[model samples]
Target: MSAFPKRDFRASMTWLHSWAGIIPTLLFFAVFWMGTLSVFDKEIDRWMQPESRYAGPPIAYDLDASIETFIGAQNGVEVTSLFIMPPKPREPYLYFYGVLAEEVNGKTYSYGRFVGESNEMLGEPQSLAGSGFIFPFHFKLHIPGNFGYYLIGAVALAMLVLTVTGVIAHRKIIADFFTFRPTRKARRVTLDLHNLMGVVGLPFYFLFALSGLYIFAGWFAALPMQTVDGVMGKSPVAFLELADSQSPKRRPRAGQSIAMDKAIMPFKTQAEALWSERYGAPVMADRVRIEHYGDANATVIVHRVFPGRRVTMAQDRIDFDYATGTVLYDQQATPATATRSWLEGLHFVQFEHWPLRWLFFAGGAAGCILTATGALFWMRSREKKAGAQPFNIRFVHAMTVGSVTGIMLATGVFFVANRFIALGALPPGIAPIEWEPITFYIAWLLSFIHAAARGRSAWMDQCFFIAILSLSAAVLNWVTTGDHLIKTMTTGMWSIAGMDLLLLLTSALSAWSAIHLRGKARQRPFAVQGDDPALQPAE
Candidate 1:
């Protein structure tokens, strides 16, 4: 009844790993690549938004003054909540966001404005470019609604299964870790690379997949909560209230007799004093969230900044009664919540440890390489089949080349378009924030078309295109902003300079890859069979 013997766990797992991974691996690659880029998201934000750039050191600003100005500028708009994000090392500008009381067409929306150290508004163009694009795209795939969340969650579950089965299938995983033969045939080389990256980065891959699932556990599986509710004979709302009793509660505004400025200033002063007394240092508020503004039940939550100390960002917080400026809650997270926070932090790398963040990025890239090569290896293995290439095989090959290299090319186009928008080269109607994604999708669609038309040559052509576009982005930045690499280095503008340097480095690597692919293409022409002596496996 079974294709393999029941006793052969390895064979069964090998089959499971191969087929289970084939389809989802493409999605996994996109997620890994985008997630890797998101590590330096704040820095990229600075690169794209020149108006928010600050060349000098971090400065302390008056939070009260900024808040007062922001409120005054609201022009009688009823704001339900306000958030103030202070400047940090990479993000050197204060940001103000307000949630409006009224919804736009039944959907609630928040408005944001950038503030300088002097508490003056910096009218930076409101665009969801740079890190904003890549960050959400990583988890959501830019898909609308909760469907993207569920879809990515399913993929994460599949990845978890693939990791477990992969471990079982590779019995000699340790040996394979040290066994890559570059001189072997193309298929062997691809397989070896796949094995090497997978084996070496297995722990990272497993943790990321597991943590991602846990982070979205609610969306992935509601049965656990449902069971709890059923057992207790309680509604979901009541259960949620019990679970989140420690969190701040939201309430409607009471329209009490309290001046907005008077209500906010005392809380700011007390929060700073309390934080300094507790941490033995002056507290720079990373974030200040005020809910139910002007209401008797209003609450203010102050989140402090402490970088590189732990995995979790904003672990410390102080809550206050908005009207009286009295401390309401000053408790740390419970052990259970702390553990969950740590896992979430590990996945996000919100802590400011540069070296560890780089390690995460490298590991994520390794995971992408592992997926890409696995697909390539599968395609190569089937190329030796006797009959004509099957439709499924061709389809997989087209998708492999298109999605893999297409993403890179599209990313290049995104950078170039960012520069064009910033320089006002685009049409006035085409907003920078909106056009960035538009350009990316158009380029990506064209890449798929090219892949379908050119077959194997698509790889080389896309790589070459990526090289040119990458270099162009760096050049464009310098020409438009007059912030050349040498000037940025001399002036200590590391954020912009670092991004430019990385772009150049990316261009070089892409060019090298293109040349290497060209040589390989010439040496072994595209074929559906490995019967040729050149395609023979190395002994």
Candidate 2:
């Protein structure tokens, strides 16, 4: 049955879009903001860890040396897997990551270390920083286990539905693309801005939502897997083992340690040549993985980093026998696998193209604006219907103010906390790596409290606070690291310099937004109009 009058598909869709969007707008905004930042998570890592600013890729590119260093550092620890990631265009330091057999509180953990060009350990902060904190937060919001993944997957599904309904509802949304009236009434302006952002960013928003859902298809498949398992009397573990049996098996470990130099010689000599010949480009491996390092059947997998390519990070791989360096298996993606890889690449923006990365960032920001404004529009329309705002309206108002402004404040706090943790200025017993999320949650909670207590002024207050915190973070980096913006830019250390510049830019933008919000609050009476028009769409 039609939700509205017959032939009023637009009206029905409008109602569906509004309610559906408002339901998950805040969560959607958080995902969009974090996902956008994650596009440059590696650059952010370089910014966070100043010791990693080593100009460019190491000239020697010694995988064996890095692996040896890692093994020495974590002596006596049984490593389950070892990965060596050599520096590439965006990442300029050798990174050695491994999964160890050691269990902490019944949970296994992974450790990553940074290696300088000289094959020596670089003392960088032992924090997740951007890649660890921000990137995962994008998909999971740091929710423990599969819950976060399932939550994000649900949100992605909702986003897809909302996008479709929004398109159907906004019959003249294309016309609104070129029609933005800033001087109009608050309600009209918010509506127009929301339409503008939604229409302009439709393609990006749609693809992001679809790709995100596709990425987490495993979570969505769990229920069906259980059903199939129950019907077939098969366990997931057994299925996994059956699948693994097709791959190369690890032989018994040899008592004597394998020669690292001899193991990687084949990769260093012929891996790149093979990849370049196959891909028709001068592809070079940036990462290598060695399984069963000391075992008779050790395997070495080399991964190529293809920069400035399309949204398909083929990352061509070739596996070799550790002892003989003979080709064991070359990863060749099937058509369906290649399509999936391309979609994943599109969402992650792994290809090294700054312009495309910036465009994706902008599109994500626009999605955030769209979500925030949509929530505010609902509040405004509700207020217009009733002379006074109800409990639900006020609650949503506070939530909108808290979440939208709160996240920005929390991000600023996270950056500042990173610097403090790096300088050892934080209080005792607070591990720098763990303190990031703590500081973020604390700031976010305070924003909610301030939003409730201070009412409408909280937006302006938090914006101002974000500006201060952002500026302070930039200044702290300069003071602590001595990597001033001017010096970094002059020396062509863009990783650090670009981050500092962005922080300052964020500060300026926050200050401007705070001032604008303050002016708007003063000019417009809180209850002058029946409509609330609580928030403005951001540029």
Candidate 3:
């Protein structure tokens, strides 16, 4: 029975799915590409920050040495509630991050980096390649303020809508899963690929969208309260205190300072001991957070996660009164909180699992394929009508080219810029780390302009650019860093090697696509497409 008998509900669903997916297809592709890159964010960081790829032995977990190093390296810039990250298998850099006692250049937090083992300060990082750039771009799109969150939230919501409407519009969802016609016409072939990917990767699409929404719920929930807090003249975090009653609250400083000689770093060892005994495993420490540092009310929280053992990143920790050896809070996740953690863990994949990481990479790639193919199918279906509505079809075609291949081209530029941009040659005002993303955004904008100018030929031109950029980035990585495939492979630095391999693979694929598109253009010399078929069954 039709849900609305007056209107063909399935036809309405088909229309809804087409327009809804079409509207944000480019944005969806951007998010999918960034999210995929973020899967190995740390590995990319290692590759970009060549200084971090230390050849020396791993640092013996000396909490005291880390403390001494942190203090002397600060150079009198007051920092509070310090968070110290030690060397791990994936992340080799010893990172000292904390809130500045007083804001500088409109920034509240300051970060200090050092080689993972040696205490020599490396100063500012070469670039914010991974954790600082690509990872954040996935959720935020680098849009300023809460607007990015709101916009991404709306896009995620649209994804859920598109997924449902697509399923409802499909007359035979089951058969579509097993059907993809490579030998068919371009219009039919893209539709088949779109259906095949959408069916196969549906769960990943749904869950990623849902989980991303959940992960940002608190920020969304904070909007109304932020307005109220603004009116009431309270600190922004005042909402968190009211909402988060589960964890211990931040204490006010008692104003009494401790001597520099006082060493409370041993608490990490004690906390690990208590946690290992409670959890029935030998758990090592990941990082330690010293809250209210140098004050009488100081406290220390040591954190760890059982990466290979559990998928739930529960953040098993023991909080201590830093002045004394007293366990203040030994945390155990509540049932409700554990449920939330499992959902978040599924989305973030913070734990170390190679196979699961690759699975997520595949899922993200599948999203990109489905979205791109769906958009292409729409363009193909509209070709016969192009003569009547030239502007609309042409406009969307330009968008399709820019958003699909343009983002890929821009990312290649980002990688290449990291290697080639000389620190000293940069304009007087621009910092090295800040310059790379600037190059990325500029490259991306130029892509849209090129697409608008070149029309349908833009697709072939951009693919060629994509291939050359990918190949250039790989060559630059070797030329600048001297870490080619053979060097990195023999040295057991698989992460760097993996990045090179991915770039080469992208080059191969884009070159093939460029060649294929070029051949099609030659055969037609005009239309490049034989027919304008309506969306139809493959088999």
Give all candidate RMSDs, comma-separated.
5.2, 5.1, 3.9
lDDT of 2 by residue, 1-539 (tens): 54444546666677778777877767887898898788889878887776666664344566666677777776677765566777677776666656566754333433455544576765435667788789978997876445677788888988888878888877576566699889777787777888888888988888988888876673345444444333221221233323333456434456556655574745755888986787698776766777666666677877664445667757466878888868877775567677777777798787878889889988988988898888877777766665564777677877888778898899999888888766888888987768888999998888888888887788889989999998999999999888898898988878788788889998999899999999999998574353333332110
Question: Model 2 misses residue 310 by how many Å?
Answer: 3.0
Q: Model 2: how large is the Cα RMSD against the reference? A: 5.1
Candidate 2 matches the true fold with a TM-score of 0.88
TM-score list, all predictions: 0.88, 0.88, 0.91
Candidate 3 residue-wise lDDT at 230: 39
> What residue pairs clash in candidate 3, if any at all?
none
Report the candidate with higher lDDT, 2 versus 3. 3
Per-residue lDDT of model 3, residues 17-84, tens digit only:
88888899888999998999998898888877777775445555455666777667666767666777
- Which predicted model would earn the best TM-score? 3
Instruction: List ranges where model 3 is wrong by over 4 Å.
Output: 1-6, 55-59, 104-106, 222-248, 305-308, 422-428, 526-539
Q: Give stretches of model 1 more than 4 Å off.
A: 1-7, 103-112, 218-252, 263-266, 272-284, 304-308, 313-315, 528-539
**lDDT (0 to 1) per candidate:** 0.74, 0.74, 0.77
